[model samples]
Target: MKKYALATLISPFLFFLFTNCNKDKSNTEETPVKDTIVVKIDSVEKKPITTIDTVDYNQRMIALSNNDTTGRWPVKAPYPLPGALLPYNRIIAFYGNLYSKRMGVLGEYPKAEMIEKLQEEVAKWQAADSSVTTIPALHYIAVSAQAAPGKANRHNMRMPFKQIDTLLSWAKPINALVFLDIQVGHSTVKEEVSQLEDYLALPNVHLGIDPEFSMKNGEIPGKKIGTMSADDINDAIDILVRIVREKKLAPKILVVHRFTQGMLTNYKAIKTTPEVQIVMDMDGFGSQVLKRSTYLRYIYKEPVQFTGFKLFYKNDNWNDWKMYTPEQLLEFTPKPSYIQFQ
Candidate 1:
């Protein structure tokens, strides 16, 4: 894990159905609405104790085994959005903050230099799997964290629209997608997401929610790893669904970052919709062994519609750290369609 300038800014340790465009909401599976979830405010007692249904260990092993007759756990089924970029191919993203140098490769190098480095990475994946069309992306943190609170009294700082537009411009020449990530701090996902509606309306722009910095209980981000309940996750989904339907555009991709079990709760209750494709990314970095363990622990056990694996160039080196090659990662039961490097 790369450290953030604000100790609280460090990213903390951190799904879907198919339906026709004309499908009726009444006919689809009904998940609990916001009222059902006890939104924890200040204390654990204030937050209702929600129980997550656990999958048996043996079942998880089976899910990880590629012994199924159908073969391949169905590649990105139904495609998250109508004109989607992922699942059909592999998405390789370079994540970081342009304002901070320590965040990722995107910021560590100059613009021309960063694009060159990203193109180099894109080349490696293109060679590794010529069959899969590779798409490059800029994973920008649009809403950053602050050591001291701003006027909102929330430790979050939002980037100006022009700044985001500038970064989006950089991705155009390379034909890359833009992922506008949000770390809500004391704010709610819905509140943070609403502000990015303009960006989300675009086909190439997607969304990422960082639970580590969510700080659901008003604590500053990066202090202690924070958590997001299923209800909170649903808020983002609803926003995307409305945008996709109203704009009459393609489906949107929502990437949720997770490392520990507590980072995200009430996994089973998450709703799936055809308009919004959700990806649960294994955001932890470590030795190959540790990475594999974390992936199996949460990703395998609590399965989502699609899966993603993240690689940290500097941080993963923490423990005898040798990064896993693309071929090595593809060896998993259901190969992850989304891959991110920071």
Candidate 2:
């Protein structure tokens, strides 16, 4: 009688415990994680991404590093890109604004010889397989202050609109790239870049930011210029990319000169504009005390193209241009993109 009574009393407790367990499970909430998807603003669809496609930026890097059949670095773009300009290479040259002038007598190599020389360089590049190819030399025209005194000093600073036209005429036939360097003024970044809208319209034309003359707010360049702010540079490059895209021009390169970190105070703001190239030119003018070390440090730390070099033509060494040739410049662990001769 006692055992039966105990069992009857515990039945209510057991039933309550079972009811509480079911209630707890019913109240619980759970949700599975969704995969990351890029919503193409236009399509508004969720496209699945494979693991390799989503994560292997490194693989893409390896492919780009590998040389093409011509032993040249191919850019991430449509193949057979116009001009034999290697997408990535150690040395892209700097041709003078009026490098090939058919001055005085009839003609030696015809004004087109400079173009021919560029072609020859490309031929040499094609001979090698997966070897380091040299990018075609680039000619930069300085229109503002903070220009290099000896190399692109005040005297030779501005390339008149007419001279620029001649260069474009020659460049088009050979498919050469040109950079129009500018020193920021009191005007905003957009305002300054706006001035060169016509030039920027061309496929080969691009902009270069010379920190040497980039001014602080209200300060004049060349005299007491201040460091460039990150936002100012970022906005400038962003606008340049938009222009290139809307115009259907080749990918424009935004070149920034930096000898030290202070030169570009806000580097993080530099955005990766689609199809636009970002090159950080380490323009160390003086003797290369740390040229090798700095090139290794900076190039590895930031994978941007490195440029600029001083030659005998430099104000300090113009008389000795012959002493240091292109071969000598290539001695750097990774060669320079271009050498700036005075």
Candidate 3:
């Protein structure tokens, strides 16, 4: 009697183990694994993460599949931005420091060679895009002035207004944008922005802020450098929003650069602003390879547009340019709308 009782208990335990093992096997079969996934940005199931550097390759796959952008389905989820595409149709290239041409390498300004290099880069991208099926928007960088504390030759970037006019003339005909870059110093955001309001008035003009250069009294961001507060940024945004709406233009894109935590002031506030377009750009300017998968999955997946990038022809070679390319940034199967060429 004792031996039979023991067998009954043992049999039940064995059965449970077999069932669990089988269940796990079934799960394995149901889930597809992937190192990369490609989806169209506007299609359903895009599952775009925040940054491309941080996705885990070993994670089990769950497809977010959408065959066409026009597919409409019943859902409680709010609609994504209309006309959104996987891998955006715009290209942004930075060429900061108009007046620092004489400052040389240490000043971090692009000299004559850099200008030619950028024009070449633009031509190259244009050449590359010629054969593609979809058309992408192009914006050239035009940072205003230089600010290096009490330095004599700094912040003198009056920008000739002539250069801006020339750039504007060139961009308008080609249907490209001219992103005005700002490095706010001891001056207020409104004051600095007022200097370039004319450009913002243009339909294709966008705004870019370099917190790295927006310091006071010789401080650099991440090293006692001052940053623009949320209110400061919003003040600018308010004008932009008004301009875009009143003028009946497209939503204006605002770019805020961040290399570390402190650099970002009031991220939540900036994100929630009404009808404002914002991109939290990673302003890492070095060769140290970084892990991007985390940001892409967590942050890029949010409602706002998240960017994957690098400042090629500048720094951050620790990771290859291939990793930051529009095709590879964020492992986003659908691709990103923005790509930067330094």
Candidate 4:
């Protein structure tokens, strides 16, 4: 696994001070409505049926399978509660943190440039597969794993609310969905997720957890690849389920990042519910052949509810290997419904 460099702006001293002064306040602050806009859904019939239409949802799910002959696809999960974003719309997300340009595409360029680049990717995916509607997304790393243990010695740093507000403001212009991703170093998933309850309650905001930096064994993050068990994932699902039911919001998509078989354990024990949709994302980077082999071994064979493929613009081309085009990825068995660029 490739280790991401630490943010240039987040020094140990600065992060420690920020952690003590603002962590609690940011967690407790009310979610602002000015930056959030209702996501536009395409009408199914003469009337708009974005919310309670099971028939359309089922048909879309089948379409997403891309006529898979294997029984693993379209995992027979529960019909999501109204307002699910999965099969109806394919998500094309730019992943990274606002503080680090080396982290991903989301932070590699200026705000305007980044949005434009994301739009370009969205266009490419739309052209590759016109059957599903493409939704642009900003997959921001809200809680990032840190090389140096800060404040509580958790080896994870939470981005300030101001930074999150900035990302939300950026998303408003493009009507893009925002995902708050967490890479828990020494901290538990429950602890990290509980702090983001207010943000996760929003209709357009989703959740992603990276097992690569989970650090369940108390090893320093980035020194070695970490893992998450089914119980760990179930904890996140349970929290999201409660949020959806209590807030009466639509289903929340939960993305779990994985590249190796050991990164995620007890695959059969992971639970799925109507309130949460899970995507086991292939998060490795390499040559086309290597990427396909990783996907086939871990993502395709594991039989998750939904699958996602990740492309690295720089890393994929390390040995002059070209990145997989959207068309190339679309031809795989159980075509990926979620596509991410890093």
Best by lDDT: 4
Stretches off by above 4 angstroms in model 1 are: 1-81
lDDT of 4: 0.77
lDDT of 3: 0.42
For 88-171, candidate 3 gives per-residue lDDT tens digits of 333545443333322122124433444455455456555544422222233333332232222333332333455555555544
Residue 164's lDDT within candidate 2 is: 55
Candidate 2 clash pair list: 92-337, 93-137, 149-153, 312-317, 312-318, 313-318
User: TM-scores across all candidates?
Assistant: 0.78, 0.57, 0.57, 0.86
Residues 1-342, model 2: lDDT tens digits: 011121111000111222233343221212112121111111111231222232243343344443224322222322211221223343444433342221101111355665565566545544432344444444553443422232322211233455455655555554455666665544456665765666766656767776655555544343332477668778776777678668655456677766544566645456655446666665543334444444444443444433444332232232332334455555543344544432
Native-to-model Cα distance after best TM-score fit, residue 98 in candidate 2, in Å: 4.9
Q: Model-by-model lDDT, in order?
A: 0.69, 0.45, 0.42, 0.77
> Which candidate leads in TM-score?
4
Q: Between candidates 2 and 4, which one is better according to TM-score?
A: 4
Q: What would the per-residue lDDT of candidate 4 be over residues 126-230, giving only the tens digit for each residue? A: 988888778899998888776667667778877766777677778777778889998888998999898888778777788999887888778977667788999
Query: Candidate 1: minimum summed lDDT over ten consecutive residues — where?
Result: 14-23
Error of 2 at 145 (Å): 1.0
Clashing pairs in 4: none
